[model samples]
Target: LRSTTVRNLDGVFELMAQATKGTRDAAAEEGAHVLAEMSPKLGSAVERQIGRLEADVEHLLDEVFDAQIFEGVAALKSHDNYTFEHSVDVAFYGVMLGRKLALGNEYLKDLALGCLLHDIGKMYVDERVLNKPGKLTASEFRQVMRHTVLGFQLVRQMPINSPRPAHVALQHHEQQGGGGYPNHLTGTNLLARTPRERFDTSRMMLLSELTAVADVCSALSSDRPHRAALPATEVLTVLRQMAGGHLNRQAVEAFVSMVEVFPVGVHVRFNGGKYAGSYGVVVKCTPGAANRPVVRLLFDAQGAPVPEGVEIDLRKLPDDGELTAVPEEGVSVEEYAHRLAIARH
Candidate 1:
C-alpha cells in the first residue's frame, strides 16, 4: 500500500510541476499543488485507514518540507478556495514551528499530517453552511463544531505510528483552560481525553499544542463564510491574548517567532504623518524584531506614486519613526506593479 501510494504521489508531483511551469518558484508551486491534492487524498485515506496509507501521508510531508513550504503559503494569497488552502497553510505553519523547535524528522512528518487533517471532518459539513456569507445560528455553529470529534474518529481508524494525529484532531479545540468546546477539558482533564488511556499527561504533547496554534492562525488569517479575513498582525495579537490561559504559552511564542508580526508581502502604513497618506509593502521581516520589517514605500504622503520606490528598514529608524498601523486590506504584487508602471510613465 505504501509503495502504491508513493507511486501515485510521484505522478501527481510530475503533473503539478508541468502545470505550474510559469511560476517563479516551481518547487513552491508544486508544494501548493500537492497540498490541494492532499485535501481529497486525506478523505480517501481516512475511509481506508486499515490499508496502511500513513506512509504515503508522510512522504507528502517530506516533499512539503523540502519545497520550502513558506513560498507555497505565499502563493496561496491568490487562491480563492479557503477550505483547501487553509489546511495547507496550517500544515506549512505547523512544519515551520516544528522545525523551529528542532523536532526530529519523524515528529515533523506527524505534525504536518496532523495539521493537514485537523479540519478534514469539515468535509462532512454542509457546503452552504460552510460558505454562507452571514452569521451562523447557534444550531448551525454546533453542527460545525462537531468536526473535531468527527475528525478524531476518522484519524483514529488509521494505522499510523503515532497517536498524536488523532489526539490533535480531538484536542486542538480543547484549550489550556476548561473553556474550549466539545469536552471543555483542561490540564489533566485534557490529557485524559486522549483516545488511549495510558498516554502520559505530564505535559500536553508539543505537537497538539502547536497544531492548535497553527489552526487558530490559519483560520483567523483566512476569509470565512461569515467574515472577511483578519490581518495577520491582528490575529497574532489575539493569539497573544489567548496565550497562557487558553493556549500553551511556549507554543504561542514559538508560532509568533516563526511567522513574525508582519509577514512578508503585507501592506502597511506608517503612523504619525511619517508616511501619512501612503502605504508600504513589507519585503522582509527580521527574526527577533517582527514589527520592524524592511518595507518598500509605494506612495508619498500625498498619495502620489514615489516614482522611485524607497525601501526602509524600520529597525534602523528611531523609535519614534516606526510604523503605527497596517490597514486591513493589503496590496497585491499586481496592484503594486500597476502603480509602479504609472509612476514610471
Candidate 2:
C-alpha cells in the first residue's frame, strides 16, 4: 500500500542495507553457488596457455601480447567472470611494458609480480563495494581506494623480496596529475611527469599506464561490474580519448600495436563499407585509418570463413581506397550471439 521514493545510489544502498540478515546471507550464498556452479571452462584453455609460459612470465605473458590476452578476455561475457580473469591479464601486460621500458631485470620480475597481485588488495574489499553499479559515495570510494595500501601491506606480509610489487600495488592508482590517493604527492611523486609525454611516463608510470590500459581494455573489451562488454574498436577510441594528459600517448600506441588493434576475426566497419570480421594480421596501425588496415575480412573468429564464407581482401584495393574507418554504431556481442543462435537453429 506504499510507494517507495527512490532517487540516487543511496537508495540502492539503503535497500541493500535493509535486506534481512538471513535474506542477505541467502542471496550471497546463492551468488557464490551460481559462481561455483558455472564451470569457468571457457577460459580454461587460455589460462592453461598462460600458465605454460616461463614462471616469471606467467603474469606478463598476455599483457605484452594483445591478441592472446583479448582472446582470453573475450571468452568472458559477464562482469564477474571478466574481472576475475582480466586483472591477471592487466598485471601481465604491465610487466611486459615495464620490461620494454628497460626496467632492470629485478624490477621487471618484481613489477610483474606486483602487477600480478596489485588488485589482490581487492580481495580484502567487499564484492558489493567493488561491484556497485553507480558512482561510489566518498566514504565507499575511500574504502575501495584503501585497497591500494591494503594490497601493498597485505603482499608485504607474504614474504616477497624486492619491494617493487608492493610499490606497483601502491602506485597503480597514483596518477600523473598528482591527484592519486593513499599518497597524493604530485610532481616527483610516484612517477608524476608532464601529462601525455611518452618519455614523461616513468617506469612506474609505464607500469600503471600499461596496467590501466590493460585493465580498461580488458574491462571494456569484455564486460564490467555494471555493464556488458564494449566493442574493442570503441574501447580503443575511448582509450585514445582517455590519453588526453592522463596516460602516455606513444606508450598507448605501443600497446595498440602489441594487441593488434584489429585482431583476426573481429567484425569491423571499414571506410565507406559494411561490417566484417578482422581482415588479417594487423599490417599497420596508424592513428589515422587505424581500424581499416587493408584487412582480409574473415567469416569467423578463425582465419577464413568456410562453405559459404566471404573474404574481402582489401590488400587488392589501391592505397586511395585503403580501409580507414571504424564502426559508427556500437557493435554488440549480443547481436553476434543472436546471429550464432540463429545459425545454430
Q: Give the TM-scores of the predictions, in the order they appear.
A: 0.63, 0.56
Query: What value of lDDT does candidate 2 attain over all alpha carbons?
Result: 0.48
For all the candidates, what are their Cα RMSDs to the real structure? 11.6, 14.4
> Model 1: runs farther than 4 Å from truth?
1-79, 123-128, 187-204, 260-267, 272-284, 288-290, 296-312, 316-345
Top TM-score model: 1
lDDT of 1 by residue, 75-98 (tens): 123123465556666766787777
lDDT of 1 at 244: 77
Q: Which residue pairs collide, candidate 2? A: 59-92, 60-92, 63-93, 178-186, 266-278, 279-296, 279-297
Candidate 1 local accuracy as lDDT? Answer: 0.63
- Strongest candidate by lDDT: 1
